[model samples]
Target: MLKIEGLNVYSDNKKILENINLEFEYGKLYLIFGASGSGKTTLAKAILNDESLKKEGKIFLDNIDITNEKTENTSNIYFILFRILLK
Candidate 1:
């Protein structure tokens, strides 16, 4: 299971996602959909540990604490994101 606690994102002193708590069960497909600038990408970036944005949260992968872990630390958990283009 993947869980996020107390997730917060700030950009230019403005809050994007605040106090976000989410959990994802293992062996299931998940999708994130939102309107434009709804912080969907920001949330994904935070999960991937992108350093560009200031974030505060605890990320757990299968009950393992990965809050301070980098994106290179991989241990069986994987994410497959599919972005379809409507032409």
Candidate 2:
């Protein structure tokens, strides 16, 4: 399970997300939808811990906080993502 609570992301000190909350569970089909410039990509990058996408919130997986974890900690998410896309 993944949970994001009260997320507030910023870029160059400009707020991009506010009071964002979300939850994802295993074996579930998830879709991210939003209009252009609605912070869709930003949210993805934040979840993947992309260096360019700074984050200002707590990210949890299975009740463990992963916010600031190293890139290696995100390998599982990326692996599944690449496999699905490559298929």
lDDT of each structure? 0.74, 0.77
Q: Please give the TM-score that candidate 1 achieves against the real structure.
A: 0.77
Clashes of 1: 0
The residue ranges of model 2 lying beyond 4 angstroms of the native Cα positions read 78-87
Q: With candidate 1 superimposed using the best TM-score fit, by how many Å does residue 84's alpha carbon deviate from the native?
A: 21
**Cα lDDT of model 1 by residue, 1-87, tens digit:** 778999999877789999999987655557789899999988877777777778888888768887767766532234332211111
Clashing pairs in 1: none
- Residue 71, model 2, lDDT: 71
TM per candidate comes to 0.77, 0.79
Q: In model 2, where is the ten-residue run with the lowest total lDDT?
A: 78-87
